[model samples]
Every structure is written in C-alpha cells, then in structure tokens.
Target: MFEAMIDPTAGPSATAAGPPRAGRPERLDGLVVGLVANPKKNAEPFLDAVGELLAAEHGTAGVVRTRKTSITDPIPPATLDELVRRCDVVLIGVGDCGSCSAAAVADGIAFEGAGVPAAVICTDAFRVSADAMARLQGSPGYAYVTTAHPLAPLDADAVRERARLALPELVELLTSAVPVAAR
Candidate 1:
C-alpha cells in the first residue's frame, strides 16, 4: 500500500487574512485590562478615567497602565512585550497630535503583530494621520475612535468629559472589528 502526502506550506489559503491578533476573549469579565498612554499633556489623566469606567462597566479584573517615553516614538520593546504578556486586551490612548497619533497607530500595528489585541484612540484632528499609519501598516481601514480635537490643553474636568463622551466609541472599538468611517 502507498500513501500520498502534501506539504503544509503551499498556498495563499494557508496564510492569515491580515495581521496577527491575540484571540479576542468571549467575555471582558475578570480580564486584566491594560492601558498604554502617549505622554502628551493630559494623556495619563484621560486614560485613568477610562480605566475606571472599564472596571465599572466591563467586569475587568485589574488595570495595568503605562506610558511611552515620548509622544512620537514607539514604545520600548520591553514595555511592549510586558503589555502583551500581562493583559488580555489593551486600550491605547491619546494619539492626540500629528506625530503622536501616528506613533499610536504604529504601536497598534506592532501589538497586533505580537498577538495582543489593541484599540487605538486618536482625536478627530488627526484621523488622517492615523489612517495613513494604518495603511503603512497594511491595515489601511483599521478603525479607531476619535474624540474631540485639542486634547492637550483641556483641564481635568473637561478631559473627563471628553473621556465620558468617548466611552461608547471606546466600547465599540474594543468589542468589534470596525471599518474606517468615512471622513
């Protein structure tokens, strides 16, 4: 008797449709939520509030938050690795300015490639930049939520308001694969 075999490495169908994604869990309940913030003004406070809400509404187990050293740079590899290791889903925030938003999108791409789910948050002012970064990363229409523009100068209460206004969008991005909205 003879048997025939085929190599597993042969076709387009064998490849993934898009960038790698950490498997999305069925429930956010009791999952450790991570927040990675760009260190632009007001960025930390905004993420802190968002963390509070995620815990309140999502049954999140715990929060782990960190910030990139600069707004326009990729997070250090060590930090990125730690985030992937420690959290179930990461909410990335305050891609508020041009360079900063681009950097956030880039980080999102990297996180996806590393098998960690990440939601990129940018302000309306830099949607174009975020879109461009997504294209550069080969997920051109990747969806990210937009808050009102000019996040840097807002006071704590105003930033909290913006964070509040952005919660629904945040939840949507965190839960689903949204296509880029028409500008």
Candidate 2:
C-alpha cells in the first residue's frame, strides 16, 4: 500500500490572471493604509506597531483594519472591498504557520487583483513558505515582510521589537518602486 502525503495546510490558491502587479503609491504622505489582521493572537498588536511606525516615520495619513474571525476562513468580500475603497495601500499581518501564510499571500494577491498595493507579513521561519505560496498563487515574487518567528508566544515587548525591526522592510515594500502617478 502506498500512502501519499499532502500539505494539509494548503487552502484556496490564486491564479495568474487574478491581478497584474501594480506599482506602489508615490508617497505615504496622507495615504490611507489598510492593515489586515488575520485573527492570529498577536497579529493585531504587531500590525498596530507597524502602523504606528508608518505614521510616525512615513507620515501616513490613516489606517483602517479588518480582523478575520478565523485564519483559515477567506477574507469576506465586503472586507476586501472596504479596504480597497478606503485605503491607498494595505499591510497584511502574521502569515506565521502554513495555512495562515498561504491565506495571507492569497489575500495579498486578492488586493493586487483589485489594483491595490499590498504587502503580507510573514515570520522569518515561514518566509520561504510564504514565498512559495505567492508562487503557487501565480503572483510569483510577490511582496512581503518578515518578522521573527513564534509571534503568538511572544510578550508585548517582544512583539513590538519584532514589529520595529520589520518596520523598514515593511516600508520598503510598501513605498518602493511605486509609480508617482499612483500616489
């Protein structure tokens, strides 16, 4: 008998036609940012820290957010629409484990499909996994930022530290290479 193994964590994936990669918005100056909280325990706080950094350092205008009730569930269409409508760019948080990482990258692809610039956050250990997900989703070489691993197990201070360390890359991904016209 042969037993085949499958990645139990794989969820829905994205297709190549889903979205064309758009250039970044020209400036964070007065740009509204959408922060996606994937309902992982520490994701919200970590994302919040990143948002704060953006606000202080990049002069971002505002941040809107949505928290998924579960990591495995798809982000509601309404939530995606809201973020797309109100925000110039989006920052999705904490693609830590397998399924969550895949889901987060999928969400990033979805935003890209909507013509929004998005960056998914993954822990250092899962960076490879998240990139693989991006490739599988048809948005190979997709943008994402990496924080230290095991966010759920961290204290607030530790989480903040990781977020702080990740802030530069986060800004780099969000602001770099954006078309001036898109701003």
Candidate 3:
C-alpha cells in the first residue's frame, strides 16, 4: 500500500508550456498594482498592508484587489485576462501551506506569462512546494518572495510586519528587469 502511493511532487511527466515571462518595469511610479489573495487566514490583511505600503512609498497609482475561489485552484482565465488588462504589476500570496503554495506560484506564473510582472508571497517553510509548482508549470526558478513560516497563525500586526519585511523583495521582483534566463 505504501509503495502504491504516488508522490505528486516527483516531477511532472511533461511540463506544460507556459507563456513568456513579462519584462519588469523600471519603476512602480503611477503604476496600478493588483493584489490577488487566497482565502487563507491573514492573507487579506497581509496583502492589504503590502498594498498600502506600495501606495504610500512606491508612488503606485492605486490598487485592485481580487480573491481566488480556492487556495488549491488556479485563477480563472477570464479573471487573469482582466487583471492583465487592468494592472501594471500584480502581487499574489499567502501560500503558507502546501497546496496553496503551489497554487499561488501557479498564479504568479500565469500573470507573468500574460505579460504582467508578478510577485508571489509565500511562507519560507513552503518554499519547496512553491518551487515544485513553478517547475511543474514550466517556470522553473521563477522568483518569488518568502516571509517567515507559519504565516496563517500570525495576528494582523504580525502579518503586517511580515509584509513590511517582504516589501523589498516584492519591489525588486516587480521592478527589476533581469532576463528570464537569469531568474
């Protein structure tokens, strides 16, 4: 019975072809930031704080917030299209668990493929799952931000602190123009 169990993370038999990663912008000034949040505990507040920081310090024009239907599901194509059309750069996150980490990474890849720079935030503990999902999505070595582990247990203030700590990497991911090969 134990041998019959399959390891889903063993690696995909064939990687799905994803879109070309979008080029990063030189700056965030007057750019519209998009925030995609899963329904996990503290995810929204964390994103809210990040959005606030971007608006206050980065000269972002505004923010558009959206919620995913489930942590394990991908963002619908239509919603992804809408975000690509409306946002200059997008931030997605709160991937504190395995499934959600994969999903969040997938979401970030999707946004990048659609020609929007995306920053994915996940807990450091789930970095393996996130990296696996990136490879499964044909985006191996995709860059994302990681906060301290056990993010779901954090209170509002704690979550905000994590967001603040994560802000620098998030900004770099969104604004740096490193070639995809280097990522």
Candidate 4:
C-alpha cells in the first residue's frame, strides 16, 4: 500500500494587508514616544528604561505607555488607534518568548501600517519567531531590536542594561528613512 505525504511547514494562509510603512522622522527630538508592553514578565520595566533612554539621549518630548492584555494576540484596535493618534513613534515589546515575540512583531507592523514608525524589542532567543511573524505580517525582513535572552530572570538593573544595549538600534529604527532588516 502507498501513502500520501503532507507538508506541515507551509507559510501563513494570508499576509497582512494595509498601506505601506509610515515615514520615519528625521529625529526623535520633540516626538511623543509610545510604549506598548505585552503581558510578559518584566516587560514594563524594560520598556520604561527604553523610554527613559529615548528621552535623555534622543530628546523625545514625552512617552505614553500602555500594556496589552494578552501575550499571544494583536493589540486591540482601540489601543492601536489611540497610540497612532497620540504618538509620533512607538516601541512595542519585551517579546521574550515565542508567542509574545510573534504578537509584538505583529503590533509593530500594525503601527507601521497606521503611519506611525515602530520599533519592536525581543530577546535574542526569539529572533526566529519574530522573523517568521514579520514575514507572516507581510513585512519580510522587517527590522527589530533584540537583547540577550532569558529576560524574565533579570533584575531591574540588568533589564535596564538590556534596554540600554538595545537603544541605538531602537533609535535608528525610529529616526531613519531606510529600514534596516534584521540579521
């Protein structure tokens, strides 16, 4: 008897549909930075440190922060709308795990589609997941920042250090007209 085989590693059924990515600002100075934290361990402090760095080093006017209710889901439409309305540039992250990493990338793509430049932050361990998510969202080769892995166990100072390490790439994503694909 002969048997048929199936391939399970196919891509997503549909890619994301929307307008092109938003135009990046020339600089972060005087721009309102938005922070969207997923429901992951240590996400808030990580993003808070990033926000502080943006303010001190890049001269961002202020920051508006929010938390998503789920780690494996896209940002709620209302929250997305609010961020787009209020922020000039946004950072979404702390994607330390598989599901959260995908969701965070999706959120970043959504913001980009809505005319807001976005930088997504994730752990090094989840880069594959983040890349797959970006491709699925029709943003193949999209750029995002990654810090060292195992973010959940880090203390406040360590998390801040990770944020500090990721700041340059984050700044580049928000301020440059050219998109730097993730390596």
Best by TM-score: 4
lDDT of each: 0.76, 0.77, 0.84, 0.86
lDDT per residue (tens digit) for residues 1-183 in model 2 = 213222324533443544786568667879999999987889999989988988998899989978977675557789999899999999897887876876787788888888888888887777766777666666667767777678999999999899999877777777778422110
From the highest TM-score down, the ranking of the candidates is: 4, 3, 2, 1
Q: What is the TM-score of each candidate against the true structure?
A: 0.84, 0.85, 0.89, 0.90
Count clashing residue pairs in model 1: 0
- Residue 22 of model 3 has an lDDT of 89
lDDT winner? 4
lDDT of 3 by residue, 1-183 (tens): 132222336565364676677888898989999999999999989999999999898899999999986888788788899999999999998898988888888888889878899999889889888888888777788888888889888888898899999898889888887733212
Q: After superposing candidate 3, which stretches have Cα over 4 Å from the reference? A: 1-15, 179-183
Q: How many Å off is the CA of 70 in candidate 2?
A: 1.5
Model 1 alpha-carbon miss at residue 12, Å: 20
Candidate 4, residues 22-123, lDDT tens digits: the string is 898898999999999987889999999999998999899999999987787678889999999999999999899988888888888889989999999999
- lDDT against true structure, model 3: 0.84
Model 2 global lDDT (CA atoms, 0 to 1): 0.77
Worst 10-residue lDDT window, candidate 2: 1-10
A best-first ranking of the candidates according to their lDDT comes to: 4, 3, 2, 1
Misplaced by over 4 Å in model 1 are 1-18, 177-183
- Model 2: runs farther than 4 Å from truth? 1-15, 178-183
**Candidate 4 wrongly placed segments (more than 4 Å):** 1-19
Error of 1 at 133 (Å): 0.8
